[model samples]
Target: MRMLHHGQASAQVDLAWFFRVAPAKRGAPVLVVCGSLLVSHTAKPPARKETKLTAGHRVAPRKVAGDLLVSGKAYANPAEYGHSRAVRVAVELGKWRKELAVFGDRVWLPGLTGSSPSEPLPFTTIPITYDRAFGGERFAWNPEGMGTGPGERGVRLPNIEYVERRITSPSSMPGPAGFGPIDPQWRPRADMRGSYDAKWLAQNWPGMPDDMDPGYWNEAPRDQQFLDGFRGDEAITIRNMHAVHKNFEMRLPGLTCRAFVKKTDGQLIELSMMLDTVAVDMEAEHTELVWRGATAAATPKLRDMEFLFTMLEPAGALTPPTGCYAIFEALRRKTYPTPEEYADDTKQAAKVRAAKAAEQQAATDKVVAEALTYRDTQMAQARARLSSYKHPSVPANAETGRHFSGIAGTIGPGIPEFGADIQAEMAQNWKMFAELFPSDDENCTWTRERVMKTHADGGDMSGANLSGLDLSALDLTGAKLAGANLSGVNFTDTWLQKAALSKANLSDTICKNTLFSSAVMEHAIFKKAVLTGAHFNRTQISGADFSELDLTGLNFEQCAGAQVNFSSAMLKHANFRNCVLPNADFYKAKVAGILFDDAVLNKASFNDAIGPGASFIRASAENLRARGADFRNAKFTEITALRCNVSQSQFDGADFSRAILTRANFSECKLKRSNFDRASLESADLSEAVLLEATATNVKFLRASFEWADLTGTDMSGSNLHEAGFFRTALKETKFVGCILTGTTLAL
Candidate 1:
């Protein structure tokens, strides 16, 4: 069918010939052919033309009986047409009889075979059918005109033919009258296209054209084929028909997809449409296309179709050919199987899922059962082992007493007595026994008689509580008085040689001229004690506390300990030669003329200590923290004081030759006339320090900071002062002869 513009000739019809073949009954079958004819601009003229004599001599044509030829004109410019070329025509042949019934049931036609004045011929009666004809039906038309029988004269009816023509009239065809502009405020009852589905379409537009179906339209090409189908004047007409159906016939399925009772109800309807099933109102939305146990599985396939529709709509896949809907529906059913097939597959899937779940549960149960069985077996074995076990028997009190008596009897004095000389030899055994096991009730109140007895009884007065006692001029040689509480006691001129006085508490005690040589005084508490002229040579005073005491002229030669705390004590002229005093704390202690020669004072803290003229020759005082200490005229020859912090201290006339003072912090210190010859002071901080007349010859002052320091009259000859800072320093008469001063920051 050729589509034509609006108001153009859509079809050709012969009323006279239609009346002859149609049945003579109301509602009788009558075919009305509605053809869509496209009028081309280059159409040829008609093949034949009727003479004027043949049209004028005929009796005045009655409007009711003759053929009503409705023709339309086409413009040269198709744009001026402003409508689709597809047209549809409808004629009610039954209605014609009702209108012309007043003129009798039958209409007569006069014969025009010959012109004879003498003999007048009779008019023939033409039977008119009272049949109803609907448009959109196929009908066959005879091309040959009505013929006359032999010896019977009759006028030949004109034959209707399909023709294409172009009209030159500038005036275009106006729309049918009595139609006004649609209301601008009109809106659709529902968002049909947005929430489009088969049920929605069926409810909102039951008579929707099969071509405009979503299943068909969504798959149609948006190219030339879509343009040709829904183009021109007919587009609005077909669109109007769709709108009328949506507005009047179809029910609103709400605006959102969630409005449906079942979430996938809309999807199922759409899928049914794609499967070529006629859509009807379902009892329950989900009941029409039952997936059995496969609704979830089938939803994705349905969504695929929805996705395809979404991709097509924006691309002008609106109107498509009628047969394409069928083709697409067929293809969709092939790709996604039917709902019955889907339900069958879902049933099988459900069985498989059930079987897997059951298998997993069975495995878990088996594991639990085995664990319980193993636990029972282990409990049984434990019970059997416990039942067969035996316990050792304990001896009775009488039996133990008898066995000890028999052992004593074997060592009893039942043999012949020894001579005087032999007995003298055995007397030494009593002395040995007394040393091994002293009297437990000695009271430790040392009278001269008790002291004589203690000396005679191996001098084992250990754990003696002799507080506030005077043991002056007492000789405790080779005594085992360990762990004794000798606090506030006097030991003037006492000799404690080779004594095991370890862990003795001698706090606040006076030991003037006391000799503690070869004594194991480990962990002894000697805090606040006066030890003037006391000798600690070769004493094991490890972990001893000698803080806040006057230990002037005291000797600690060869004294060894883990550490000794002499903090806040007086150590004037005291000797610490060859001492092993690691981690010693001498905070605020007076060490004037104190000797620390060859001492291992590693990690010693002498903060705020006054040690003027103190000697530290060859001492290993690594990591010493002696801040604000006075060490004037002190000797530090060959000391390893690495990373020592002696800042803000007095070091005037102090000798530090061959000392390793790397990374030392001597900031704001007084070093007048101090000698640091051959010292390693790399990365030392001497900021704001005074070094008048100090000699630092051949020193490694690499990366040292001397900012705001006074080095007046100081000698730094042959020093490696690389990367050293001397900002705003007083360098009057300062010597840097033969020094490596590379990268040094100096004041201009």
Candidate 2:
């Protein structure tokens, strides 16, 4: 049957086999199916019949439907409108009824979405179906009144919508009365999900005709002949339907094809499509051989494959063609070779499976043996005390531990205790383990070549000793190095982010500029290691040791390092912003220009540290210590340093505004030029402190001590000194305006 766009004219339909019909001369026309449309092309034929589909034959009786008329005009007959051709077209309509036209001499087949043809005048007019509903007027066959009105002149075609930031409705097709502004910016509703798959088309193409009936095409029955191998739900996705170059792709059992239409001519002119299949040749080992019962025969060998080849074709105007059937039939006549030919029996298959399992187990055992050998060699070298053997840089005094508190922290208390001689031997083994791995090589592991080869062969070395390796600039991000011995390893500029280093030994390891962001390093040792410019953002460093390290310019943002040790360390310009470092140890640390902003440092220690230019803004340091330390020019704004022991410290040029230092000790501190405005120093001890040129305005000094303190040129105005003792104090030139001096002793 012939298809109709607006029930106007008719063209010949031919179901010619692509490989047999297209002319071999120069460049012949061919139809190729690409995704959704049928595209046409003109390409030169091969010199020889290279395709196995050369034996394919054309379908019989290619004439689908005949005899039709449109708008009372007669279409071209087969004798004049070239030769008849067959076209298989599948249309995708979401929801719409098929538009029907008049039927007379030659019946018009139901179209994808639009109108059918009328009467006996050599039928014409092909239909193009889209997967959507574009509301407009339908093309009617007006045989009685031709060229009467504008509607009778021609049929209108729909246009695609442009999804832009803003959309303005056309003034011609104005919205209903009482509607909002006509040029209002278009916005997709939440329920609509997006504009592409909206039920109603809101924006129409300007200057484009809308002739499609939104409610039609849904009731139309599809012809099975045109949809032979189609999955019955063939439609381009909403995202790709409006693309500039549209293609419909599909794969059948033994064939593949693409359907598309040419748009260079600016019109939906023709359906172009292509199809492809394969061919093979085979023979049995014996002509009279029983193919099914030869498995028990002695020395039975599988049949050999003779030849295998591919066959490509251009299925021009072939709607549900018969050439595909012939190709598959030829393939069926031959037997394809497979791996089953070798095994043939269930027992053989089981043997193959067991062999593979055994091979895998053997490989795993080999790797384990190699790793043991490497570890033993390292231990033996350390015991020999050979001059040629190199050792890792561990803490000088292992008993005191370089960073953490005691000996147990250095070599891990988890290590079993031994006698004196055995302990010495173990210590040497751990210290010298770093010599086995190379620093500059990519394979920086114990027994470098062996470990490297093992890893390449997909072997596991989770607990491998990689100590003292020069692992600079190594890309080990997200590597599973948990529980690995990484002591004295040089990780300068290495990518260790998101690596599993939990409980890993990183003692005395140099980590300059190393990236450990988001690493799982809980309880990992970093004692006495220099960690300058290291990135530990969002790392899990809780229970880890960082004591006695020079950690300049280190970034620890969002790290959860509770109870972590930073004792006696040099932390110049280090950042601990938004960290959860409660009970962290910073005793005797050199914290110049260090930042602790928005950090949770509750119960942490900073006793006897020198922290110049250090910031504790918005930090929670309740019950923390800073005794005998120098905090010159430090920022403690909005900090909670309550009940802290900051005795004998120098707070010169410090800013403690909006800080809570209740019950804190600042005894004998030099507080020159310090700003304590709006600070709460209730029940605090400031005995014998030098407050020269200090700005303590609005300070709450209730029950505070100022005995023998120097307050010369200090600003204590608008302060509440209730129950405060200032006996034997040097208060010359000190401002006491608006001071509450109830129960205050000012004897000096």
Candidate 3:
């Protein structure tokens, strides 16, 4: 037999003496002879004789050649044969043959004999071949057939066929032989005998209860039960073990097996044998036996000796097989579907996406078609309207006698006779026609030459239909075009000085770099108009709707407007100097770097406006509502802002020097490092205001409340603080030198 060492080296070991010890009863003389015995031929052999020897009897020792012999009365106990109920012996002896003679002579016992002189005590002559002892060479030791009498059934191993059938069968193995509990009726497909079918197992296997199930194993939370249960240390251990199993391959170096014995009273004893380690678990006791060759005599005894099921070690690594426990778990969680089902699902999803795309395309096509129809209809109506404004023929003047050609040099040939009276009448007729059909369609076919000629002939073009006409670089001075439908007209670089455009619809007009100096454009609609770099100097635009516009860097110098809507407009760096814009709405306007110098902005709504670095110097902003505004670093020098509510605003580093801010609400304001020198803040509420390091020197603060105000490092020297409230105010390092502080409330 070949014995394998720790280094995987092989050594030849003769195993002939393994079955030499004969089975004997208790207190009986048993001989344990090892190795072959040689007798000398020179001397005659001693004859066998019967002798009565009592217990503990001893015989004198004798020697023949190199052989020594000793006889004594000895007893043998079968219970002391091995420590465990089963002994696992790993051997690789040569192929066994039938009828192999182990011993030639029978063992003679002189103590017990019958009266039969011809009969001798027989030695065990049983054949030890693989076919007779273990049924086949593939068979290993079976604890079920151990401790039986000397016969064919004693050495028969059953695990060879049992493992083969269990691994190759379509159905799951029986409960006692399987690793864990499984549904009895569940079976794998015929084609999945050698491979694992995860989908099939998921649908068939019974999972844990809803409270214990961990749900689908993915990287997100799906079910509440999974979120609650799949946490803490137990989940961490499982994840770690799973990762190790996936990353590393483990294998047992030596023989391994598992066996379980059932007692008569239904108690089971499970045993696992791996190399020299044996782990046995009984119903009440668990023990681990380590087999050291020299110390094998000290093992503890076990109760049961009969095994119900036995397992042989597989031929590969110790990693889980195809249908292992890990596979079972993944199947129960339904982590993935079968290949065929997945393909079908993908195809259906593609169809759904294609259908949705088709619907969206159809809707877009319908909208485009409707827009084209509307444009065509508007164009037709505009053509009909323009036809009604045909120019009237002029009568010949007798004084000039040349077909009324008083201004023939300017009027080209092949045109009708031109005269001041006829031109005046044509202008009046066109104006009346515009007032009759005043539609801001923007598709009016008014050529640039026609508009210029009408303006040149007469300045009375009131209620004219000049929509969408490009009058760029034209000087339309002193023109009367009030109530005109001038929507979408391009007036780029045009000088409309002294033009009357009141109630005119200039929606979506492009007025880039245009000049409207001294124009009367009251109550006009400038919605969505592009007025980039346009100048409205000295113009009158009362009640105009200019909301939500981008008027960046535009000029409104010396303009006069009342109730003008500039809400939500982007007015960055815009100039409104010397303008009068009372009750104007600048709500939520972004007026950064805007200039409102010398403007009359009484009762204007600048609420929620963000205008950092703005200059309002010498502006009259009485009763202004600029609450919650961001005017940081703004210049308000010499401005008169009486009764203004600028609360909850950020005005840090602003210059309000010599300004009049009487009865203003500056509550919850961030005015850090602001310059309020020589400013009049009488009866103002500075509650919850943060004015750190602000300079209010020589200022008037009469009856102003500084309650809950933080004035750290402020300079209020030479200021009139008469009857001003300083309750709960933070005045750390505040200077009040040379100040009139009479009747002031300083209950800090």
Best by lDDT: 3
Please state the error at residue 648 of candidate 3 in Å.
0.9
Colliding residue pairs in candidate 3? none
Off by over 4 Å in 3: 1-445
For each candidate, C-alpha RMSD in Å? 40.5, 33.8, 36.9
Candidate 1 regions exceeding 4 Å error are: 1-446, 746-748
Rank by TM-score (best first):
3, 1, 2
Model 3, 1-748: lDDT tens per residue? 1111111111211111111112121111122211111111113332222233110011101111110011111111234222212111111112211111111122222334422112222321222212222122221222222212344443222221122232222122211121111111122211112222443222211211222211111111011012121101110100001111211111112323333333435443343321222111111111111111110101011112221323233324332333333433243224344687678768888999999999999999999999999999999999999998966445433444674566676766644555766998999999999888857754456688877877899856678888888888999887788999999999999888888999999999999988888999999889999999888889898998889999999888999989999999999999899999999999999999999999999999999999999999999999999999999999999999999999989999999999999999998899999999999999999977999999999999999988668999999999999988775578899999998888764421
Task: Give all candidates' CA lDDT scores.
Answer: 0.54, 0.54, 0.57
Q: Specify the poorest-scoring 10-residue window by lDDT in model 1.
A: 286-295
**Candidate 3 lDDT score relative to the true structure:** 0.57
Per-residue lDDT of candidate 2, residues 89-129 (tens digit)? 12222331112221112222345664443323322322221
